[model samples]
Target: MSQIASTDWYRAGAHGIDIRVRLTPKGGRDALDGIVALADGTSVLAARVRSAPEKGAANAALEKLVAGALGVARATVAVASGHKARLKTVHVDGDARELSGALTALAESIGTRPN
Candidate 1:
């Protein structure tokens, strides 16, 4: 679970943190499974969406999901990149430390205790 908070996935951006997420569209439900490590040592939040990867529904769901997880306004979250790919970068605008704390809590909820 240490990989979830790894610097390799999220970075402090000009306005906020840019988090890498690997979304599974058409998943049975809208949920966050935890962190997943790529073959190349990259880590991403493993998220699932009930919406299909069409007409941007899945992207919207992902934004909402991430916003909820971060305890921020839905409008503050955006799909920064990878709109057409499973792997996406989500841009969240808010207090960086507060957001990080929220993410830490989320990680704990999923049984990934931060060190």
Candidate 2:
């Protein structure tokens, strides 16, 4: 629904993320990739999914991917928005700072450098 050039997400706690996401399905993988955009017009971790968007396959894949990236249990990540749309919301259940560092590290790994 909206366009964000980029964003830097930091996990402060289980609910560190106070942002929005515009998910993009990169079908053809078991992993999830999409843009997590914030109000400041920042985004990062453009996730890519190997699974096709069907029967929650994409959703599951997204959860796994994000959880793995965040180093938290898949159960920790919950879809907070966009069930039937390309966009979705995932909430973390932990410390805000941890999530932030994790996100920053992930961004660095992918050379995305979210800011």
Candidate 3:
């Protein structure tokens, strides 16, 4: 099993992950925005969304898009803040480094890299 599987982070009801996400919200032709990468052990994945924040639709879409991409259930994701802003929080369940690396790859594909 992956380290994420061994840690309590995935234990449900305990040890949540933080990702720094960046939303793109119509970067051009892309239907949805890309998820920006944050450091590990953070709940700010910096996920970018192509949908505008209209009546909480963007936020919901973001949750689905991000959770799908991360291979986690939507229950694992939530907007800790920035409901009307571009940046938001993404809670995950997994190992810090593993999750971070996955997000970094996703971000890189969209021409963004984590620091």
Query: What TM-score would every model get versus the actual structure?
Result: 0.88, 0.69, 0.56
lDDT of 2 by residue, 36-103 (tens): 45446556445667767778877777788788877888888876778777656677777777677776
Please, what are the lDDT tens digits per residue for candidate 1 over residues 32-112?
Answer: 887667777777788999999999999999999998877889999999999999899999998887777777777668643
Per-residue error (Å), model 2, residue 93: 1.0
Candidate 3 vs. truth: CA RMSD?
7.7
Q: Could you give me the TM-score of model 1 versus the true structure?
A: 0.88
lDDT (C-alpha, whole model) for all candidates: 0.82, 0.61, 0.54
After superposition, candidate 3 runs with Cα above 4 Å error: 1-14, 26-47, 94-98, 104-115
The window of 10 residues in a row where model 2 has the poorest summed lDDT is 2-11
lDDT of 3 by residue, 1-115 (tens): 1112122112222455565455656543223333323345322233455666689877777778867776777986786667777766556765656665666565555442333
Which segments of model 2 are wrong by more than 4 Å? Answer: 1-14, 18-21, 31-44, 113-115
Best by TM-score: 1
Maximum-lDDT candidate = 1
Better of 2 and 3 by lDDT: 2
Supply the global lDDT for candidate 2. Answer: 0.61
Q: What's the C-alpha lDDT at position 48 in model 3?
A: 50
